[model samples]
Target: MSADRATTETAGLMDRMYRHQRHIYDASRKFYLLGRDQLIAELDPPPAGSILEIGCGTGRNLIKLARTYPDTQCYGLDVSAEMLATAGRSVARSGLSERIHLAQADATCFDAAALFGRDGFDRIVISYALSMIPPWRGVIAQALRTLTATGSLHIVDFGDQRGLPASFRVLLNRWLTLFHVTPRHDLPEAIAELSRIEGAESRTRRLLRGYAIHAVATRRAA
Candidate 1:
């Protein structure tokens, strides 16, 4: 499929999947979505910095991050209009609508300047969304393009679970499939190669016996 067509289908699938799930996504996933709060706590943005979340579903993370760092500006994009609608209401309820901006766009090829009127951001995060995005590597590349010289990118997602019991891994993957999630086993090597080519550096840490992975990559000054 052409890029545009693929994006359209991705959006459709996301909307269909989250139309109702968005309401209970947080409560249900909190048990398995490990390392999210740790990633947010470590996102130490620069003074008055700008932060963006590529797939900011339900605006949960964005809202928490905003409250964590009141001096920063927050922006988010998600392909699902259904999720964005829920996110908007959540943000308004948190009384953070003024500090948070939301937009509907595909994460794989978004134009930051056009969407948020900024060339780049000081911090960017992707929280457990990569496994659901078919073109996850493309989304990572596009997100890197919006990183300022000193900016950093953070990602936390399902890991290979190699350190866990074989039976557990099997059951986890099987259950995750219901949500269209496929853990990217090669995430470490992929980001290492991407960072090398981009003149950046990255490191990933496995959490909970590889149940989740967290990465932090920083680009050198130009």
Candidate 2:
């Protein structure tokens, strides 16, 4: 399929999946979607810098980032209109409409400058979104292109459950399949390769016995 067609289809699928799920997403996801808050805690954007979240579902993480770093501006992009609608309402409810900006765009291929009137961001985050995106590597590369020279990209997502019980891993994978989420077992190696090619520094941490993975890739100096 063409890129646009694929994006549209994915967006439709996500909307159908989250049309109702977005309402209670944050409340229920708090259980299994681990390491997200930790990733937010590690986000140290530059003073008055800009932060962007690639798949800012329901604007949950973006709201947290804005409240945590009041000095920084926050931007979010999600392919699903249904989710963005919920996110918009959440941002408005938080009275952060002035500081947080959101747009509907495919994470794998978005024009940041055109969408948000910015060239790059100081800190970019992808929290648990990679597991659902079909072209996750492309999304990571696109995020790298949207980073400032000194910026860092942070990611937290489902892991391979290597340290967990075999039965648990099987059950977890089955549960995740219902949401169309697939743990990218090669994520660490992919990040390493991308960082190497871009002259960036990369780090990975396994959490909760490989139930989740956290990664950071900082761009190199020119």
Candidate 3:
């Protein structure tokens, strides 16, 4: 399927599933959404710069980021209106409505310029979101394109569980599959290829025996 068509379909499915679930999304996702704090720690945003987050469900990360980097402007985009609605409420409650911007847009092929009235972001993050996205690779590519000259992209998602017990891995995979989340088995290779194409510096590390965190690829300033 074409990129646009795939985006449409995925958005439709997410909207259907999250229409009601968004109310309790942040409360429920805390259990299994691992490595998010680590990703946030590595965010190191520049002072007075702009940050964007794709697939930002419920704006949990954005809240933390906004609190951490009060000097930076934060933006989050998601494909589901249900998710954005919750995000909106979170931003309002946190009183970060001015610093953080939330929008409903396809992460894979969204036009940042059109959506945000800007061309690029200084830092972009994708945290454990790739697994639920069907065209995740395209999302990464689009993120790269949306980066400023000195911008960086950060990602954290499920790993291959290479170090975890066989039984645990089996059960975890089974549970994640029910939510349409699949650990991309070839994530390392994919990140390597992305770095090569962008001619950007990349670093990857396995955390917790690859049961949770995988690799972090960064394209340093050119």
Candidate 4:
């Protein structure tokens, strides 16, 4: 399928899956989506900088980001219109419509310049999203290209569960599969390769004994 068609189909699928789930997504996900708060805390975007979140379901992270970094501009994009609708309402309810801008776009093909009138972002965050996306590597490349010269990319997602018990891993994977999530086993290597190709420095940490992977890649492009 073509990229546009694939994006459209994926959006439809997500909308169907989260049409009702979006209402309680943040609340339910808070329990198992570990390392998200850590990623947000470590963002440390520069003063008056810009932060963008890909696959920003329900705009939960964007709202938190705006509150955390009041001096910065925050933006988010999610393919599912249903999720964006909830996100829009949530942002407005929080009185952050001005500070938090949102759009409906696919992470793999979104244009930051077109969506947010910005060429690049100072900080890009992806929290627990890669596992649910099939073309996750492409999303990483797209995010790197959307980063400013001195920008950084932060990511947190389900890890390989190497440190956890084998039975636990099996059970967890089964549970995750029910939600269309598949942990990226080669996440660290993928980040290293992409960051190197983009002239960035990348580091990854295995958190919760490999239950989650937290990665940060900083660019020093001239």
Q: Write down the lDDT of every candidate, Cα atoms only.
A: 0.93, 0.95, 0.85, 0.93
Clashes of 3: 0
Residue-wise C-alpha lDDT for candidate 3, range 1-222, written one tens digit per residue: 786777778888998988988887778888888888888887888889998999999999999999988899999999888788888998999999999998888887788888898899988999889898877898888888788888888888888788999999999999988888999877778877886787666667777889665455566755
TM-score for each of the candidates: 0.98, 0.98, 0.95, 0.98
lDDT of model 2 at residue 51?
98
Model 2: how far residue 9 lies from native, Å: 0.3
lDDT per residue (tens digit) for residues 107-127 in model 1: 988888899899999999999
| Cand. 2 TM to true fold | 0.98
Query: Could you give candidate 2's per-residue lDDT for residues 101-174 as a string of tens digits?
Result: 99999998899999999999999999999999988999888888889999999999998799999999999899
Clashing pairs in 1: none
Error of 3 at 158 (Å): 0.3
Better of 2 and 3 by lDDT: 2
Error of 3 at 6 (Å): 2.6
For candidate 2, list the clashing residue pairs, or say none.
Answer: none
Q: Against the true structure, whose lDDT is highest?
A: 2
Write the residue-wise lDDT of candidate 4 on 6-119 in tens digits.
Answer: 999999999999999988899899999998888888888998999999989999899999999999999999999999999999999999998999999989888888899999
